[model samples]
Target: MLLGRLRDPYINYRHRRLFHVLRVSIALTVTFAVVHLFPLEHSSWALVSTVMVMGNLPHIGGVLDKGRQRLLGTLVGAGIGLLLISLPIPGRGVQIGALVAIAIATWLVFSSRQAYAGLMFAISLLLVIGNGAPDFSVALWRSADVLIGTLIGIAATLVILPHKATDVLRFMLADNLDRLARLYHAHTSATSAPGVDTRELLKATSALLVKQRGLVDAVHREGRLSRGEVDELISYQRRMLSTIELLLESHWTTREGHDRINAMQGLRDQQHSLARDLGTLAFQVRTGQPISTDISPFELHSFAELAVGARGTDGRMLFSPSGYLWLNRELARVAASTAQRLASLERLPSKRLRRRAGRHGLHEAQRLDSKEGSQNDPGSH
Candidate 1:
């Protein structure tokens, strides 16, 4: 029973977090051992460098990028320190003034997104100028220590349970898609409980979008995803979110006439079919598999026909048929596009495949939307 109660925390612990902890522990241990064994000056600086470079749960790509930045920063900083030390500025006030100016410049660089280089510059300057007299030799030694620590951190990340940023990106995308599918179903289903909070679903989607930006940054830092791929993925996610918002709006507009609409056999069948397709697509995304069905277009343009044939014509449904058909068509397009995006990511090794996926996905969506629009209202086309 005691063990059973203790299981919750273990069960809740994320694999990513576990691996991150392990990676950091190993890197720090190795860094400490190296500093103690070697005749390196300022061994504590090495430890600090290792900690900074290792970061917390760094992706393989991020580790490499950070290491590179740290090394470059150290070299540049050392050079600057040496230059400053060699300068014949007679007064101590002038030297201090120069140091302060350099510090301000470093801060500006850091704020402008070149954080790694700027940080290194600052460190080098401080190390050389901190004493009563500037010491180029000490600055050089400190730079070497930083470089060594950075290399160790990079090696540990590469060799010890290395986590790929791309994998995290994939998992996050799949999870969000799954949630979106559920939200779509809930909004469209007439039988969904009154307690179902659409607001919460929207909030979750918004949060996922914010998370996606961070994931993209991580992937970029790791050097896994190219600019084109990142842009495509971001565009697809935004379109999907927009489509969901449209679906939610449709649901609210039709809620008052739910019984009458649900009573219609054709409309109900189409909604069910679309919901099933969305769920299947969600599953495919989660599993990193291609969707079996080639979601071609709204094969049935019967919404207008069905509405005209019905006996009792209500104002609530007057503009609703067109709106419903348009919304459904939009949903289908978004789903198909999303599926293609996933397939592209799956076969991401080939640049040609990615290009084709984007081209074909957009073409297919446009064709479907055009066909539906022309069929529903010929003038709009």
Candidate 2:
């Protein structure tokens, strides 16, 4: 039982962060050994460069981006240092004035996208200036050390036990969807289980979204999810959360509304439908399988007809018994879109494989198409 729970995506994903920590630890140890073997002067700079490149990023794509930036910055900085060494500066006063001007110019780094590169340029210049005699070889040597550290850090992450951001994203989404299912279950239980506050869970889900936002760029860099697909996923999640929140905050949460829903057979059926749909969605997301059947409505219009008489004298839903019905319609729309996106995503790999197969594999492609067709047939369900 314990093994099963550990294997579950919702629980297994939390350990991914620890793997990254281990990767950094290994990289740092190797870097120290390299520095000691080389017996390079001012070797602490090498350690700094390694950590700067690998400290936060775990995935290949993210590490690549950081490594590229770090290398670019180191090269640029070293070039500036070499230029300073070759220049005929008059005296210390002029050198201080130039350093002050460079310091002021550093603000551009903060405003620009390639801030790392700019910061490195400044650091390299400062290090060159600090070392007396303006020696060109020393400046170049320091830059080389920095480069060695950067390569080791990046290589350790890419080859040592690489982790993909795509897997992290899939696991995170599965966990969030499961939490959403539980939240919906609790809100629905408000009828019989009053005061089952879901505000915290709702808040928690939003916080999870904040973490997801950072992962999207890494995943996109990895070429797992495209820009359009990211937009669709974002849209579905936002709409889903908003509609669920509206339902929980509406009059249906009160005991009086619960009594009214219990009295109506149709509303009760719709409630069950919503619960079942959410459960199905959670399973589909966790397993990466798509249902072939058309997405079902969260609440039937026939149920809305049954709720027609449940309005205020002013004809406003204003926390009336029918308010939940409209929210259900909105939820149905979100569910359909979410399901459609998942279905299309699941088929993408097969589509790519067949296209790559060419005329030489035409027969095999045909077989695959037929197999896929059978899997996607609505009638099979």
Candidate 3:
């Protein structure tokens, strides 16, 4: 079971690592080919530039972002270079001052979200100053060569065995949801404290937030996603997480904590219901389609209610009519929900459909009766 849980991370790391190795190797090969096939006036400079740009491939998105920044910086720096060189600077000191001013301007302008743009600006500034701003023709040619190298670098970074941010987002959704389910079960079972792992959960939740946010930003940068399905998937994840937070806060409240065990009697049933919905949702996300089947909405709503109702009550009163049965039902719902989602992701048959054979009915009935009014309501019945 533990090994299964680690599967996603293991696969993701392997794929990314492989991609890094392959992409870097290919980029280096391309650089060698470029140096041998098309010799430049400064072949060493060309090779150095190629390596600098291609070296960034392992950090795809970051390299692209930096390139954009560098472009912006370069444009501003070039303009500043033109003005500084055009000025009536009589001595070598004044010329040096002008170059410094242009470089600083480029740095400042390119510093925005795109670091690469700043780099471009600085490089352009230095090149132009060193060449004494030779006819615009010469400066433009050097800039063009640099741009070509930058393009090759960016292309290498984005293309080789590229992984999508959406994949990470989906993985996180499943991982965190599974953890939340386990935590909820533990809290209700008295196997764990109400406040335990709240910090960890919060941290995981924040990480999800960051990934989701980045995914959206990425899609926007693409101008549009393939369709609305991805957006809908993101929205569903947000809703699922909101519901999870609600359940956690309800469970933690002192007022609800004591009575919570009982009020959450229906939790199991609710979990079952939640599992179905979560499964359907995850399927839609994975396949990039809308949910074709309807999910039982009441299960999640009821579980949420039960969680809230169980708050801040006395532990002894946990077996009362309003406590035990309600909580048990809620727990069943939660368990079912968890199981369903997990099954969907793993492509496994759900536990709900598996029936145990040849159990003694009388013994089961007796056990159920004995536990009917008990606080520690296990869901075996």
Q: Pick the candidate with the highest TM-score.
A: 1
Residues 329-348 of candidate 1: C-alpha lDDT, one tens digit per residue: 77778777766655655443
Report model 3's TM-score to 2 decimal places: 0.57
Q: Which of the two candidates, 1 or 3, achieves a greater TM-score against the reference?
A: 1
Winner on TM-score between 1 and 2 is 1
Structural RMSD, model 2: 8.7
Root-mean-square deviation per candidate: 9.7, 8.7, 10.8
Off by over 4 Å in 2: 1-14, 89-113, 131-133, 190-197, 252-264, 288-294, 309-319, 346-381
Off by over 4 Å in 3: 1-14, 43-64, 75-88, 92-111, 131-142, 166-205, 211-217, 225-257, 260-267, 291-381
| Preferred candidate (lDDT higher): 1 or 3 | 1
Where does candidate 1 stray beyond 4 Å?
Answer: 1-14, 92-112, 193-201, 221-223, 249-260, 263-265, 288-293, 305-317, 346-381
Better of 1 and 2 by lDDT: 2
Alpha-carbon deviation at 33 in model 2, angstroms: 2.4
lDDT of each: 0.63, 0.65, 0.49
Q: Taking the tens digit of each residue's C-alpha lDDT, what string does model 3 give over 271-325?
A: 4434434444443333333334344433334445554444233444222324333
Candidate 2, 320-342: lDDT as tens digits: 55666677777777777776776
